[model samples]
Target: MSIPVNTTAQIWVPARRAADVTARGARLLRMADGCAVFAVGSGTHHFLTRGRPRG
Candidate 1:
């Protein structure tokens, strides 16, 4: 499954800060107060996803 990326930006979250969520597949995540939190990162991988997507 190839997710459409901007390519112009890259996002890289620390392995510790990134949470793995299992649904259909393993997904990286981050949350706060039991609810999803907002985040963005440096580089061409930069992304602002509304929520986790099954990878």
Candidate 2:
């Protein structure tokens, strides 16, 4: 899946394929330890964080 470049917020990509961010409406971010995590939901409605395997 591809995200449009016109998106307002920043888009993140996972280092591994443990979770399908596109299927869950989520995005991946890099941590200080170089690990990857998925961020789901927007604003304060609902949010989740999950660890992903390293690439």
Candidate 3:
């Protein structure tokens, strides 16, 4: 699936800093190699809701 442009509000931080960011409540989305992605702010909700398939 592709992330919506408008709702994409995330930050890429080094794996070491992932814990620090998460400690502040950012949701961890992905981690690969030594990089990490954390979703922040209200855009996360918008992104999730917009991508859901309606019945």
Estimated TM-score per prediction?
Answer: 0.18, 0.24, 0.42
lDDT of 1 by residue, 1-55 (tens): 2335442222232222334322222233445434333332322223233444433
What's the lDDT of the predicted structure labeled candidate 1?
0.33
Regions more than 4 Å wrong, model 2: 1-23, 31-35, 42-55
lDDT of 3: 0.49
lDDT tens string, model 2, 1-55? 3433434343344434434334355555544343345554443222333566455
Q: Rank the candidates by TM-score, best first.
A: 3, 2, 1
lDDT of 3 by residue, 1-55 (tens): 2345556566665554344333244678886555567676542232121222222
* Candidate 1, residue 51: how far the Cα is off, in Å: 21
Residue 7 in model 2: shift from native, Å?
A: 20
Give the top-scoring candidate (TM-score): 3
